[model samples]
Target: MVQNPARRTALADAAIEVLAREGARGLTFRAVDVQAGVPKGTASNYFSNRDHLLDQTARYIHERLTPDPVMIAELLRAPRDRDLVKALVRDIFRRISEDRAGYVALLELRLEATRRPELRARLTEAVRDELDANVAYHLGQGLPGDRETVVVLYLAMTGLILEQLTLPEVLGTDGLTALIDAIVERIVPAA
Candidate 1:
């Protein structure tokens, strides 16, 4: 209900940090206020309730994680082939690694969503939209993959990211890159 966009975004961003550091249980309005360095009750003013805060924070994280259009355009200038697909997927992992907190908070939201139907519905919708967009982009670019290929890569990347985040020692840096290359090589047909 707050009309101040910047202030609302700041509150939502703070809520993400709280969710990342403290999990969903620790993401209270007061926690967000402290994280944002704002007056007490400031978060409460911006978010009608905890659900509202979580919803906005989820959206904010997605927006933050979106690749820059300029970067995407630059990548597109290269030939659309298996190598390009690997590069694109590699860029995705790089972005996720760069925003480790955002991804962790997203995982927390997934756990919270399992217990909250409304949040689950919203996340489901968001996930579906992202999947659809990826399929569309891959097809439109004439990339070496169909929808199913893209879907498989999505699942593979999801698993890789999960392992990288929770068990970094399992994959390490070199293993991660090797796995990405292997997935792309096996999944995307050679052009």
Candidate 2:
């Protein structure tokens, strides 16, 4: 259906809230409407079905995230070294910890993808594109090595993020910063 960008964004954001709080099964059209404080059929008008709503929610969350340009610029001004990598990692983890539900929604999408092959392929492609863009971002900064190094760093940071989000206490109160520093030192080769 044709909807204004603002209206669609609002509906998708509301749908994300529903997905985060109630999981995929509970993300009904009425639920999104209620969450958005719009009329009962508003979300239905914007989205043809639950799949449309869910896809929009996933995309909305991704659109709203991605490291801030200003933050990236500021980081770029700093020396390209281990500390810089730590700063970037810390920025990522900080954002993740702040928007826990958004990450939860993404994780839920991953789980739901297992049962939906089309969604799995779509999400895998989307994630791969993002990863490639990330590699380019790293190389553009004149960071050492190739995409493979960045990919390895991505995996390590992902594990740390998973642990931090799911079990912060497991990191032993050293917190995101210290853990971030450790990973940057260990995984990121000196440039």
Reference-based lDDT, each prediction: 0.92, 0.81
Candidate 2 scores a C-alpha RMSD against the true structure in Å of: 1.5
Off by over 4 Å in 2: none
lDDT of 1: 0.92
lDDT (tens digit, per residue) of candidate 1 on 159-185: 999989879988787767778999999
Per-residue error (Å), model 1, residue 85: 0.5
Tell me the spans in candidate 1 whose CA falls farther than 4 Å from its real position: none
Clashing pairs in 1: none
Model 2, range 86-148, lDDT digits (tens) per residue?
Answer: 788788888877887788778788888898887788888888988999899888888766788
Q: Best candidate, lDDT-wise?
A: 1
Displacement of residue 167 (Cα, Å) in model 1 is 1.2
